[model samples]
Target chain A: MTKKQLKNLALQSYTKDLLDQKKVESVARLLTRFQLKQYIRELRNSESQKTINIVLPHLPAKTDQQMLSRLFAGKRIIYHVDKTLLLGIKIIDNDQVYDLNLKDTLDNLFTFVSSGYD
Target chain B: MIDSQKIIEQLENRLMSFGVDKKTQNMGVVEKITDGVVIASGLSKCFMGEIVAFGNGNYGTVLNLDEDTVSIILLGKEGKLKEGDGIKRTGKLLSIDVADTILGRVIDPLGSPLDARPKIKGARAMPLERIAAGVVEREPVNTPLKTGLKAIDAIIPIGRGQRELIIGDRGLGKTAIAIDTIINQRVSNDVICVYVAIGQKQSTIAQIIDRLKEEQALPYTVVVVASSSDPASLQYLAPYAGCAIAEYFMEKGKDALVIYDDLTKHAWAYRQLSLVLRRPAGREAYPGDIFYLHSRLLERAVKLNKKHKGGSITALPIIETQANDISAYIPTNVISITDGQIYLEPDLFYSGIRPAVNVGRSVSRVGGAAQTSAIKSVSGKLRLELAQYRELAVFAQFGSELDATTMALLERGKRTTEILKQLQYQPLKESLQILSIWSVTNGFLDDIPVESTQRFEKEYHEFVSSRNPKLLETLETGEKPSEPTVTQMEKITREFKKIFSF
Candidate 1:
């Protein structure tokens, strides 16, 4: 089968923003072992794009969590906290990040100042 | 020194006005780590030759892209990266920082200071790999780029903006000839020199730097080094780095000379990187684009027309052959790419010829058009005569009686060869080089024994300078000799012949 056909098969394995177990099993049966691995990775990537991870300095109140859920609507919204972020929040969308915090700003400033010497 | 008040003012202003903007980047996670290459996934937006930064401050260039991953060659010492490490796109192409301050400084491929000196500032970025100037922007090479060696200057003359390959076996003074060319530029002081040392020993490179410093050639020279201990990515980038620096000067309407100490190791470095990245290899296990690897670099050697500031970059690329085999894969590729080659032979080198330049095989495609009219008139028949002498010498080796004319030809050839044997680091001026070749080619040195030819040529130059400085100055003008000049040369030869004892 053509690679485009395999890509379409992988994309179709999901239903309503999540992997359908029955559809995945039937698709896996149709593909060779190598194609199955690629199809699974594509499925994982599609699933990942449906979720947005937000890291903050402290846990948000229940109202704020509900607000984030409302903003994302049907997409998955997971929140975590780390003290090192110092202030503000970080949003990670798979391989890309939207960092807005004092720690990252300070880190970028330090890197810029130190690199001038090298 | 930095201004204290300005810094304080800037800090206050930044504190009042600074706001963080939304900065976005495509990122990747390292999936595998080979010797110096990193295989990364999720960099689907990354483009080839784009510089990517690791979290730990190390950098890499994306070399290959596939269906699921990108292969990147790390640009420096391994930064202790493991699988699952992260990298971000830098939004930059690989380039070297260049400015007037870079001249005389030893730098690495990334333009970092390597000579323990202060870092260069206010440098504009010149891309390491640039498209060469097209045909419409180019002018034909018409000016001489003298090496100050008798054989090369008179016979195989190199022109400004020419790509001349210096091919030879190991330890045959190929680097010495290149150094001599760099040092000889001191006379003209019109060319900026860039010497790129690839896969060479650090100690050797240090010695070359020291020699250039002692000769005062360092002031106009820039030494770019990617030593053997450096990573293959750096070694592969050395020549292009040097070329970028030279191109900086060329674009500014100044002549520049770039010497790639040896490109054989450069080919090896690329081959290593290709194999590690799992690219298919051709003959000698080198990648199929091996020829393109050098052609793109050498094609950057161009002479811009007057409309483009009339600048030029002369390239002297050295290639080492194993056991004098020029037909080998890498050597033949470069030999065909360059304008012409100076073939250095081990046989000539071992037999006491210093530069070891094989005149028969060595040729300059630019021809005598690059030479000055003075050297042109005198050395016109020198190459043809030497060819004839070599052919007759083989017959004379049988000790058979020959015509007097053949004997005369052989005598003149011997003296010519002796006079061409120059010592290292001693590059003669154009006038003196012309005088030596003129004496032999005009039959003035026929009666002088071969053994005394060296002594004779040395004293003759000194005598002309001391007694008749004006005549030497006339020859230095690079114009054809007037009748009075020829008459004076003959009279001086007659007088010197009487005073000299062989």
Candidate 2:
């Protein structure tokens, strides 16, 4: 999602929490506790290092964490197994994406090769 | 006939021979897009003036390198460039291809073919911005660059490598003078001409091209047009591009002439680009670097020394003034940068003086040294006589009675001014110009009426050409007139005077 879309989603959830807060006193207390936890998580997210969201063909073992950290130092790593990735990895940083998947790489290579003749 | 199978086979072989290498590229995201300017972030490695590419494959030139973002001026159409589109550095500064084939062609600032003809081939790329030749590499201006106008050739002669500013209000024949100069180059065998039209109307450019075509000067001239419809970036780049093309020939040890037809619009375009890029504006809302911009461009006109093949570039930069305000910021900046100025006056233009050159204001500092001796011998006395006549004519106008000498001076001045009035696009040869000026300064035209001076000049030139062609040849070969030549000219002038009736 874009930064703008993410901000809009946060505003919608806040409105939902606000409506739930006025329902019942017991439920309102429980909602306040949950809101506090959500606020803390947001603060942590803002203060933590930028996250690098990665998509791979399959989930790797936990033993690969050290190697992944070595490759992307000082960056928080999150993984998602995408079946369509086929054989390689796709890493998305803040404003740039590293397309290392077989399909995307082949597509880029075809374009790079064909554009020369034209 | 061409074979499609063989072409396909060659293409396949080429594609197989090419290997893809994985290299990390510095990337950025467009933060904003406004008025052909793109503000992007994460392009920290991009240098100033570097060429960059957008996601849509269009290109831009980096103008502003900020802390986190860079400002790029788009060189092409602004369509399909989104706020979050990807940007990548091309690692190249702005440059254009220049070659001999560019002559007789009309091109945009980026060297694109605007004439709708076939694309030029064998062009070598030259950077738009370059350092000018240093003082040690240059020699003093010692050869004349004639404009074919009698008044200018007499008083305000331009040297081969001098920068002469043509300043005047609009409709005062500024461009006419430049076009005449270019047309005059037809007689000069070695001079290459480049005309850069910046921010002018499309119709006006078309008319100029049509005129050039009519004159048959297109074979030796290159026209660079960045009209009012072009983006400000292209307008700002036009003069520099023209200079680079001229410099290409200059590097090959050839004489070249480049004309910036009115830099006022070029300044306005630069101001627009600077404001859009958010640079700090100075006096007149122009950026502080405005002076430097023109200085660097004009400084490129130089006369190289012997070791550099004796090539030179003469610059004639036209600046249009509002209400004849030469003290305005742009005019003064350019006047100080150029060697001298040819100030054209609207009043003179209205008075039927076609060239309309204001003698007192127009001066050429470096031209005297390069003037031909035959012209120099006659022009010096003519200027003094004209200046004196102008001063005394105002005094003589207050009273009907005057001395014979004062009457003679006024008559001479009137006739001299009439002689200097020349039509556009008909550049007189140096021999003919010298012959005309020599006759008047030597009192041969004193008996001729003021109204009859133009007729007398035409008859005298034709008589000399038809009767004694060797005299004109001698003058052309840079020989000053001896007693016999003067006697021969006088004999013919007396005969023409008898037959010439007012």
Which candidate ranks first by lDDT, i.e. highest? 1
Model 1 interface CAPRI class: acceptable
How well does candidate 1 match the true structure in TM-score terms? 0.92
In candidate 2, what are the lDDT values of residues B103-185, reduced to their tens digit?
99999999888999866667888899999999999999998888889899889989889999999999999999999999998
DockQ of each: 0.39, 0.16
- lDDT agreement with native, every candidate: 0.90, 0.85
Candidate 2 clashing pairs, residues 3+ apart or interchain: none
lDDT of 1 by residue, A68-93 (tens): 88977888888888999999888877
Per-model TM-score on C-alpha atoms: 0.92, 0.86
TM-score of chain A of each: 0.85, 0.49
Q: Write the per-residue lDDT of candidate 1 for residues B1-502, one digit (tens) a residue.
A: 9899998876665555444353565789988899999999878788889999987789999999998789999999786788889998987899998989998899999999988998888899999999999999999999999888988999899999999999999999999999999999999999999999999999999999999999999999999999999999999999999999999999999999999988999999999999999999899899999999999999999999999999999999999999999999999999999999999999889888777999999989998888999999977778878899889989999999999999999998888888889999889999899888888888899999999999999999999999999998899889988899989988998889899999
